[model samples]
Target: MGVLNVTPDSFSDGGRYTDIDAAVQHGMCLFREGAHVIDVGGESTRPGAERVDAPTEIARVVPVIRSLFAEGVPVSVDTSRAAVAEAALEAGAVVINDVSGGLADPRMASVAAAAGCPWILMHWRGHSREMQKLALYSDVVAEVRDELRERADDAIAAGVDPSRIILDPGLGFAKLPEHNWALSAHLGELTGLGFPVLFAASRKTYLGRLLAGPDGTPRPVGGREAATLATSLLAVASGAWGVRVHDVSATADALAVWRATGSPKFLGTRTEDK
Candidate 1:
């Protein structure tokens, strides 16, 4: 998966692809780079970010999704609002990557059920503005697992098929750096929820902190590609069904290497052909 944030306030690469033409071109580039799916977001869900109205989000994502769908690329709308999801689906998006786990909007599950599309229900406590304050967890893994299970049940009850559902642990949403690391370390626990697990830790703050410098300053988003690739491979090894990423070519190459080596040990070494 390749991330396409159409919003101007996303933590990484926000304003870089807001225009429909530029966003479509970038989506094509990602497809050429080996991304199987393009996840498009109209709103910035970075911690403490303000929420954009449904119309604005629809305006941001629908045209780009329509253009990509016309070109035959599978697109997933990264929205928690039912209205945005409906409009994106109407515009030809095939999947809903809801970061709120259907909690933010009352009609999200029903809209997904009606569309009969694959829905990624991520573990989330609140919107970007209030999510960080809701990160308190006694056992992060256990809590995440239980919450996702309940979310799946809720979606099923709301008419979404169990097989069409995917689970995301909401790596950066509402999670502290430690919680994100813990989820990464124990990803198998979340994947055990019987749905395809989507690990989306691309250029997240946790990776930056993991690769911090001697002065303890976290690395910038562009500088975290190496660490992001490492974590992506790790997620795959841990039984993740899919990895949401920005640098899809590097990840695709890594996966090819892993398969060629018959899943050899991951020792943090470059496996690319020289």
Candidate 2:
């Protein structure tokens, strides 16, 4: 999956593709660059980012989605609002990548159900602005797995097809660096829950912190591409269904290597590095 953030305030690549024409072209480029799915998000959900109204988000993404889907590109709407997801589906989106896992809006499940598209349920405790404060977890892996299971159950009960549900651990949403690492290391536990798992670790803050310099300067967004590829490779080796990455071609290349190499586990056991 290639991430296409259409908001001006997103943590990475914001304001770069807000224009409808630019966004469509970028989506096409990503698609040609080996992106299996192009995820278009209108609002910036970066930590501490303010919320954009549903109408504004819809307006920002609908045209882009319509244009891309018209080209036969596989597009996913990265929205938590039912109205926005509805509009995007109407405009031509085949998936709903809801960061809140249908928690943000009570009607999201119904909308997803009605659309009959894949709905990605990410582990989220709250909205972005207050999410960090809610990252507390007794055991990050177990909590996230169990929470994701609950969400899957709720979505199924709400009329969503079980096979159409995907699980995302929400790496940086409400998780600290350690929490993210724990989830990444133990990703099999989440994937073992029988849902296609999506790991989105592209240029996230924790990767920058992990690669911080001696003086404690975090790595810039552009510098995290290597780390992002590393994460993508490991996540694939660890049984992730897919990775949502910013650098699509790099990830596609690395995945090619993994494929050529017979998908050998690049790193040791999940617990070894941890």
Candidate 3:
């Protein structure tokens, strides 16, 4: 998956793709660079970020999705609102990557079920503004797995096909550095939950903290590419179904190398044939 945040305030690559032309161009570039799916998010879900109205998010993503869809690119809308997901799907997105996992909007499950598209349910406790405060966890891995399972159950109960559901551990969403590390190290637990797992630790703050300077300053986002690639490769090795990343070329090259070394099969598949 390629990460394309078409918002002005996403933690990384925000304003870079807000323009419709630029966003479409970048989406095409990412698809050409070997991204199986381009995950376009209109709202900024970065920590401490404020929420945008549904219309704004729909406006930001629909044109780009439509353009990409016209060019035969696989697109997923990264949104929590039912209205936004509906518009994106109408505009031609095949997937819904909801960070809140249906927690943000009561109607999201129905929308996803109606669309019959793949829905990625990430483990989220709250919105970006207050998520950090809800990061408390004992045995983070188990808790996340259980929470994601519950979310999956809720979606399934709401008439979403189980095969259409994917799980993400929500790295850096409501998690602290240590919690992120724990989840990353133990991703298999999540993968073992009978669902495809999406590992999306691309240029997040925890990676910056991991590669911090001697003076205690976190590494900048631009410098965390190496760390991000390492995490992604490890996640693949640990049986992740897919990885959401910013640098598609590097990740594609690395996965090629991994495949050369006898690539292992991923855990699960989406309902639609790939």
- RMSD for each of the candidates: 3.4, 2.9, 5.3
Give the alpha carbon lDDT tens digit for every residue of 1-274 in model 3.
9999899998988799999999999999999999999999999999999999989999999999999999999999999999999999999999999999999999999999999999999999999999999999988999999999999999999999999999999999889999999998898899999999999999999999889999989999999999999999889989899999999999999999889755364324333645
User: In candidate 2, how many Å is residue 92 off?
Assistant: 0.6
Two-way lDDT contest, 1 vs 2, winner: 2
Assess each prediction's global lDDT (C-alpha) against the native: 0.92, 0.94, 0.94
Clashes per candidate, residues 3 or more apart or on different chains: 0, 0, 0
Q: After superposition, how far is residue 151 of candidate 3 from its true place, in Å?
A: 0.5
Please give, for residues 1-274, the per-residue lDDT of candidate 1 as tens digits: 9989898999999899998899999999999899999999999999889888989999999999999999999999999999999999999999999999999898999999999999999999998888889999999999999999999999999999899999999998889999999999999898887889999999999889988999999999999988888888888888899999999899999889877866545545566832
Residue ranges of candidate 3 with Cα displaced over 4 Å = 263-274
| Stretch of 10 with least lDDT, candidate 3 | 265-274
Candidate 2 vs candidate 3, TM-score winner: 2
Query: TM-score: which is higher, 1 or 2?
Result: 2
TM-score of 2: 0.96
Which is better, 1 or 3, measured by lDDT?
A: 3
Q: Judging by TM-score against the true structure, name the best candidate.
A: 2
The local lDDT score (0 to 100) that residue 146 gets in candidate 2 is 96
Output the lDDT of residue 251, model 1.
90
